[model samples]
Target: MADLIPPTGRVHWVGVGRATGSGLGLVCDEAATVLWGRTVARAEARLEELGLAGGAEPRALAPGALARELVPGDVVVAMLPAAGHPALAEVALAGEAHLVCPGYAAPGLSPHARRAAERGSVLLTEVGLAPGVDHLFAHDLVGAARAALGDRPAVAHFASHHGSGKDRPDAFRHHFDRAPHEALTALLTPARVIAEGLPRRVARPWEEVRRLTVGGETFEAHPAGDSLPFVTTYGLPATWRLESFARGTLRPSGWNAAWKPVLAELAEADAAGVAALAERLAAVHPAHDADRDRVVMSVRLGVHTDDGTDWAGEWSLDTVGDARESATARLVSVPLACAVLEVAAGRVPPGLHQATDDPEAVRRWLTFLTARGIVATFRGDGAV
Candidate 1:
């Protein structure tokens, strides 16, 4: 079997569902292998599809069983739903397994993070694109702002367009049919480490679709999810005027408007209603099928110095699936693959760490991905 980790250290992989498997399997080749489930037909099919060939067996996600075989669960890659994560995050830390993922915010991350830190095992989340790399980009901007002004700026604006291009809105409805609640209609969701001061603002998802025109192309974004936490992570002052948002990326015109009705109705709809909405939307505005999917991210930061002079900068990244895989899978999974390796190599720290603290890791990931097809760019390099 491909064992990218040491022969003696085995990784217990949980939630080997479709997208997570795609990501977990990529970083693990001959170094450290998944201790269980490799031989299962579905896993085998996935591995075979992803260009990995191994003879490892699939086992249920049991800490005891895994500990017996892999011995002390030193490393784990979890793809369980956000709600299911905290308990497992706790278990993995207790087992001494350094953990990582590309997921959105979860209550579990902060709680178990402390235990992982005391134990010297890392627990990393939001290590993927939007939440992950996007944070890293925020740190860079803050660093630049400080370099220019010698102190934190008085005001900053952060926003993003992070969404999916589904086959049909309900194309993946079967996946969420059972969870009638907790859909995007209910929730919403950046950056950097001065590691001291943070300016924060919170808003519901898509509630305020801030409009913008970039490179002659206009798009919209909105505030969502705990973005205020970043103001602290970046070491901005409480008085620092900060506004940040994360929204779905869209086409130049009418794309967001096209789906606004469905999303508007999301709160009132059950699973069936949501599914019907997606299908109906697809009949007129269909998502790309079989063709590669893509994620386009833009992080724009505006800093107004205490003296009132203003400086602004931006970072843009566009990635699509390779001929071998989907971009959504790659953007979400690949950085996570490298993160697992970081834990294995002792590069990342334990405790609820976000991707922003690891700039070098981010650079390496972006570089490696570029070799495969991801495109990343930085603008207004000097204003930083």
Candidate 2:
């Protein structure tokens, strides 16, 4: 492990987007916090909206603006798009400050991680919602299976989905920050997954939609990204055989039926046509203030030996938005807040790291999330 820079107890949180929620309050409670937004006024407004008007300082985010205020040992929490992470990371490394983000660890971050380790600064990623809590569940399940079955060969399958809790008759239910069509368009790209003990490419993931039941509710699920890499990340025993594995998005039941027309339109629509369709869909299905969002994630694993000894278990999270905060925002921000605190405490070594797999750290994070009313239930045949 590299020598970690002692934290200064000051945090600079960048961006005040929809995903930014009560988690900010948690960080504010423990650190001298500053909230950065597109403009100083926008940052101030968001603070007021979050009921944290005077809880933290508000600043405008511009090129070099955040870099100017950063100092060694400070923590920078990025709540912006994935594309902006590298730039913010550059700023953090230059200032010898730690950086944290909820997004996946893109390839661009590899070099930053090397530099961060050398500079004694932490760079934590994937500590929110599906990537965050789901990771905890997977690690715990795999650890339990290993203890019980001890490298025995077994078939394993994993899936995660996010859908609206409230039923909507429309084609789409959730609100998006960008063009909704782009999300649909991105689905055209292929994803890689482990299936039948081999890696396979899924050209049209949406075409392979399958029914997934979580917490007694059935929803539509399809793989979203490359999942083969996570087999190593989750520390699965090399001796175990994988039947199926995927990390995917979940949608309400009957999503395919509702999306059929939209998919057909996207197939042949040009750029201009797609933009028009997006505009039309936005108008037809505008989000309502009364709407409530929900997020559900489940990770299940099973192991078996030739003697027929078996171990099966699952950990699932189901949370809905409340008057206080949206479910997506709460789930995403709170775990991220937890990671920031851990980094501040110098528990995480300086370098690039995902949500911790250490048993104690996993327990601590899950317990903290439970106390905040985000609980993941475990149901299995064996003790975990």
Candidate 3:
């Protein structure tokens, strides 16, 4: 029996599920010590697989009890769903433990963030692949553009595209790295994005698709979630001609034609209907443990000055997973894992925040990723 001990200044992984646990397990291998808190058989199986079953402490405890046991200086990595975040964040705040997650911060995260700030604990969210890495690249590019022009550019356009699946197409033409239910649910979720300097609700996101070519392969980019908040977060000048700013999910070519109608139906479906749809989709796109997944990300920033000078910059990352983990999981988890370690080491500032825009921090994080065999490159004139 593992006691719900207070902050020993160690890492605590609060859940062990199929999609997220493998990445968390990789972090466990890197950390000096970790408390593996989970309720599933997969938890034990993963630890044994990682050769840490004998070393890492595994506690099959509930989240509430586990929260009470955390203490100041502790790093709590929540590997659960977004629905469970606010409650767990409240506990981490009370325990004064730094909280990090690969998921987006729920709307209810504000209060928890405020309390965490008062406690001097950092609550960092959106540290995964698409939102996380995309945020970093966007911020860096915007900053660089402003610096080059010696002022905020008169016009700024920002866009990001990222996605993952099998290197080759299958029956469904795509596969999900996460639970099919989660993927299906997200397909219909409405988001507010900025387009031509106006806020718009994108109910059927796949309808707004942009195409791109990476490594000689074509992929379709569709608006995933809102991009307005990030435009502000990146500190792009509102006074500038902010023509367009959007973050989108990337998929193989022809994905838009295939998924558009399917998402339209899901948007009008009830809970039961959604469940049924999820089941059908899952059956067609069941994950294969032996399959190697890939992650492709591209972020672009374009700015124009009245002086007739124009500047455009872009950052791209394309990686494939090895035997240890899926490319999707590794890309999503490693940045988060690095963030957790940095928080525990007293390097990260204390506060509720989204992905960081600090240049040095971004550089350090990217360097870490490059060392892990991730092929990342920045190409732009006078770009940071």
**lDDT for residue 3 in candidate 3, whole number 0-100:** 19
**Any idea how many clashes model 3 has?**
1
Give all TM-scores, in the order shown.
0.77, 0.94, 0.89
How does each model score on lDDT?
0.57, 0.83, 0.73
Scored against the true structure, residue 293 in model 1 reaches a CA lDDT of 59
Judging by TM-score against the true structure, name the best candidate. 2
Q: How many residue pairs clash in each candidate?
A: 29, 2, 1
Predict model 3's lDDT versus the native.
0.73
All predictions: root-mean-square deviation over Cα? 6.1, 2.0, 4.2
Give one digit per residue, the lDDT tens place, for model 2 in 226-278: 88888888998877778787888888878788888887887778888878878
lDDT of 1 by residue, 1-384 (tens): 111222134565665554553556655662466634434565565556766666334565544665454445367767666776676676665565667767754565776655666666667778777777677666666666666666554766655455444323332321232232343434422222121234434443444455666544555554445454555565554555665433334443444566466567865767677667556544554334455455567766766767877777777776655567666777777677766766676666556777645446656666765664556677864442
Error of 2 at 216 (Å): 1.1
Greater lDDT among 1 and 3 belongs to 3
Stretches off by above 4 angstroms in model 3 are 1-8, 19-32, 40-42, 260-270, 382-384
Off by over 4 Å in 2: 164-178, 270-273, 382-384
> Candidate 3 lDDT, tens digit per residue, 265-382?
7878899998888888778777777777777888988888876778889999887776776777678777777777667667767677787878888888777767766668888983
